[model samples]
Target: MYQCEHGGVVRLKLAVDPDLGPLAAELSSLARGAGLDAVGITGAEPFGSTRRHLEQRKAAGLHGGMHFTYGDPARSTDPDRALPGARALVVGARSYRRAAPAPPRGNGVYGQVARYSWSDHYGPLRDGLGVVARHLEANGWQARVLVDDNAMVDREAAHRAGLGWYGKNTALLLPGKGSWFVLGSVVTDAPLPPTTASAAGGCGSCARCLPACPTGALVEPGVLDARRCLAWLLQAPGTFPIDLRPALGGRIYGCDDCQEVCPPNRTEDRRHPPPPAGDEDEPWVELVRLLERTDAELLAHLGRWYIPRRQPRYLRRNALVALGNVGDGGDGRVVRALVDGLAAGDPLLRAHAVWAAARLGRGDLVAGLAASETDPEVRTELAAAGLTG
Candidate 1:
């Protein structure tokens, strides 16, 4: 009679094992001892609505530049593809949404980085899951832990395991823990029993997250249009649509506007602590500093926290878009940076720089860009940037 809470139409079974009780207890304690918020176990199965939503998101070209693993059904949805012998998944969640410090307005422009990007969740999550896997291995079971890059839909697994439910923003929302948590999982060949109950969310008519999106990316409950999603725009690897450039505002990296506006995440107690020192004080990361970060500087600051899957140039290009959105031609410092940035070898980098320079209304920048811009794509960007303001 038990069913997946989020994907209720799908039938699932709980393969209970007597030994799992102690192991679950041990994992709960281990996760907490290691600073994790919650952890649970579930069988390997397709997360009902996620597959449908992912297909729709991809079909609409909303995927932007991110070719998500799940975008391919054979590779992502099928548990057999990820691990031939996989039977159950051990899912874990952690809270990284800290209380943001107040922004010192007027003194400087602020840039918003998505909460997840602010820290490195993979290392700790992987390490903890590895420990959990080892514990299961000791009990005569085969275990393997995977992070965000893997094919499995982590939020779906966690929800089915009674860890949380999908929110209107498409994030996993736990009852008391809030939606600010990061997820981790350990897929194993062992036949561990599944949790008796699925995490049917208690959203209860609360549509707080639906209308908060600036781009209307969340078309309906639990659906996200990645094209309109500013987060995707920032992460896209190639030239962005010039029309949406202004809506990007001062966001140099990822956009937290949607999450920032989430009611569940707004609670004061659930907020994480402030950045320790020598970092952006509050409201958000600053835009001027984002535009100024060199490749090495960006890697040095964020490389440890973010997965180095794509080249760092993608992020630099995003910075250019942000700078163009906020930069005024009057600010000689930013203009010079944009001018200098256009000379870089990466076409994506050069292209975005052209756009930024144009937004700042620098005729000198256009001349300089014309002198060095060889890539046809960049030349197009230069022409577009020049026409913008």
Candidate 2:
């Protein structure tokens, strides 16, 4: 028999031909052997709450330029949409808890990347999931697998599979193991052992994650307003809402304040090496240097860590703001980079540069960039920054 809880249905039944348990167990063993902390089976169904939240995130324009998975709700939520006969989902989580270097002092000059992004999660996680999918398919089960790329609400699947519970930050936090893990799933026709109920949250009225968000993006327990989130800010393209830029501080990559304050996360064992002391590859960049990077150089550097899917203009804009925040305007190098980026196309970058130059009391530089500027919109922005040549 099966049960429906949390607005979804669950069933426990034998796989086809009733001889599937041994093979499924073997598949589970292989996944664990591959460095995954946990693997469990869940019944296929739409993750209702997660889907609704995702829709709300998009509708509120909180998704910014991150529209790839936002375009398809059914395909993202319903496993059946991925595989017609998919009756079960095999969910897995790989722990990535590594110690981080202490953040640099004062101006928040060197912000940290989120733990999951600290390593190349996709290739290894997908490889392991694919291996499990193959094992199931070899046993005549139709299987399809995916990691963060798909339209799936992976955190909910992890919870459903008894791997973890959603913390106040909306991340899946496994007991004693923390939330620094990457999640993946395989959908298939095989009926496997249903996972036990996941542990209820251990947060217990803790508000550590809430106050730590520089932009107050947490909103409330288990709810997030991505509009104000620094995580979204770094990846957002096009025009940034004026209100969000200052809150970004100097974070050039992603935000980690919330996780850094969490008790469990603080104690977790970090297996990866510490980040570099100073290099082009360090997590946060001096806004001035980022603006200096050519499009090709920026692409090469960011592609090593981030997926450069959005328009490059947003990243450059962010770099400009970071420069302003760090008070790096006195440097001739930064001034030169701003001049170069201003000279280049991309009205978005020009506008941000105007704002940055004004904040740095460099109206003269703005005037200089505006002198040869042919774009009417850019001239308007320069004028708005109190620059006229």
Clashing pairs in 2: 76-151, 97-270, 98-270, 99-270
Clashes of each: 5, 4
Clashing pairs in 1: 15-193, 98-272, 99-272, 101-282, 103-283
State the lDDT of candidate 1 residue by residue for 1-389, as single tens digits.
Answer: 23466855432233555556777778667866776778887887656566776677677766654675545744666565677767788888877766655555674556666666665666777887888888878866677777885587777778878897777788888876577777878887665777655545566787777788777778888777777887777766567777787788876556676666666666534464434423432336555675577768867766653332546776666667777777677876776677767777778777777777767776666675587656889777767655322
| Candidate 2 wrong stretches, greater than 4 Å | 1-19, 56-69, 102-112, 269-289, 304-310, 369-389
Error of 1 at 267 (Å): 3.4
* lDDT (10s digit) by residue, model 2, range 1-389: 23366755444444432355676688889888777788987888677776887788788776655654566866788887888867778999986655555655644234345656655666778888888998887765678887875657677788888888788988888887788788999988887767676655578878799988888888889777777877776776556666677776766677778887887776554533433433322444545555666778877766655434645566677777776666566777767866776666677778777877787787777766767777776777677666867
Per-candidate TM equals 0.82, 0.83
lDDT score for residue 97 of model 1: 62
